[model samples]
Target: MRDLRIGIIGVGVMGADHAERVVRRISGARLVAVSDPDLPRATTLAESLGSSSAPAAGTGDGDAIRVIEDPLALIGNAEVDAVIIASPGFAHAEQLMACLEHGKPVLCEKPLTMDTESSLRVVEAEHKLGRQLIQVGFMRRFDPEYAALKQLLDSGELGRTLLLHNVHRNKTVPESFRSEMIVRDSLVHEVDVARWLFDDEIARITVRAPKPTGLVADGVLDPQLAVFEMASGAIADVEVFVNFQVGYEVRCEAVAEKGSATIGLGVDVLTRRAGHWGGAVPDDYRARFGTAYDIEVQRWVDATARGEIDGPTAWDGYAAAAVCTAGVQSLQEGRPVEVEMARRSEVLG
Candidate 1:
């Protein structure tokens, strides 16, 4: 079989990383085209990958990679068989619709869309197409540690998990990163984790914050607490601290009737110094979850070659947006808010 011809939209941090991965690391796929609002950035990435990279096995060399000025044109490009959307959240809905219209499979980076309604619209469109054509980029599901935890939970070894505790910390944030972004961007991962691990929907949510870290200005909750009540009678509490100033760290612990399991305590080699014993914390998420991203993209490439999606779907994206909607509302109102979501059957049908 010929290598899957992949085009990536958005050459920002995540998009550029994905483009390099496709050209250099991933098998059964080749980077053929890229598009972004910043034409110079996209052109630079395309030229660099096209000129320097060797073709993957089974994919003959000398395929010309181009920079399409429009993301929709990239989606509709004849040589492009699939698309990876690393664009901003606000741009996702339109680009996703274009992919569906062109019958191109997509691996859209998180947020799926900025809000629940647009996300559901994508779901509805794909459902009407009579196939699953979109996969939301929830990379954590592909992480080895998280996958192991999931397998253990599924095995009944954990014996009906009752509580899940997650800690999401970032070293810093851009000035443009607003307070609501803490819920929409960072904590959204925990929301999906809760739904995925428990195999249930979030029933209600409440947001509370302690004193803001002195480093953060007023009105921004540097560290916040979010409580999610799942439909399965389980609870998942997430502590999202964007200005932790230490390093990027994500930890999850599952408490079950029989026992408990914790992961993400830094898997690097431990050190025994003159007086200290410790391990290095990743400076950012890219350092921490690099392997997971590779696996996720490669799996998507493999599945799209077979006319299928191997990971989270558009409904999963919509559900995540639904929960985050309630979360942001709770954060604003300073009260517990019941999650409102349409049944899958209702929306898909």
Candidate 2:
């Protein structure tokens, strides 16, 4: 099989990792082109892939991969069969719309858009296209533990998932990140996970911010709780902490009519000479969900190669956007916010 020519739009942390994987690990996907606002960075990344940078027209020896400043120009490149969007959150909607307009398949990072109105535009464009061409990168569904738990739920072992309790904690975040990014950036995953796991839309959202602990310094919003009411009448609760002062951690438990299934921490315990047992924890999300990321990328490539729409659809993105919007409102108003979701015919069909 001929390798699928892939282009990356961002060369930051996540984007660079993706480019490396496509160049080094993946079988049928080639990192043919890369674009970043930073021209030198894009050129260096293109060179590292054993492909030189191409000019605007992408004309050169086939060995040259184009490094462009404009993301839209990269989208229109004939050599790019599929695009991976790991750009800033604010750029997602515009880039995705361009891809759909060109009828190119896109794998976009999550939240679909940074805000609700932009997210709606993406939804409207997909509906107009009459097919799902965008796959939102909610990699948790690809996670092995989460997938196993979902399988158990599907098998009736967990019977009628009643509630889900999730915890997401990070040791720290840079002070420059907006205070609200804690919701839009960090807790957004929980919002998506709730929808994916329960296969339900959130009906309402409420947030409660308690007094800050000394453990969390003045500038940090250490712990925040988000309450969700699912359309299925199930309840979901998430606790997010940015200053947990420990290794990165994520935990989830599903309560159902029959039994409960939980995600085990990916850690091994050892006995210390001091007479205490300790286990090592993952330091970051990449360590925790690295396999999931690989699965997500490969699935997108495989599905796109077959001209099939797979992975999280645009509807999933819209739904998560709605929930996240409500989450923001809940935090700001200090009251429960109703989540409104538009129905998608593609999702039903």
- Top TM-score model: 1
TM-score, prediction 1: 0.97
RMSD of 2: 4.0
Across residues 1-349, which tens digit of lDDT does each residue of candidate 2 receive?
A: 7778888999987898888777666667777788999889988877766442332212222366668789999999998889999998999988998999898899998769988778878888887878788998888989999999888888886579999999998877766654477788888888888888888789999877787657644655558899999877999999988777787899999999988878956555665777776777777788788889988888888898898866888778888888888887888789999997766654344
Local accuracy by lDDT, each model = 0.90, 0.82
TM-score of each: 0.97, 0.91
lDDT of 1 by residue, 1-349 (tens): 9788889999899999998888888999988899999999998878777776365532235566788998999999999999999999999999999999999999999999999899889999999999999999999999999999999999997689999999999999986787899999999999989999999999999998888888887789779999999987889999999998999999999999999999999856898999999989888899889999999998998898888999999999999999999988998899999988888878776
**lDDT of residue 198 for candidate 1:** 96
Per-candidate RMSD, Å: 1.4, 4.0
What is residue 242's positional error in candidate 2, in angstroms?
A: 2.0
Error of 2 at 222 (Å): 2.9
| Runs in model 1 lying further than 4 Å from the true structure | 57-62
Error of 1 at 276 (Å): 1.5
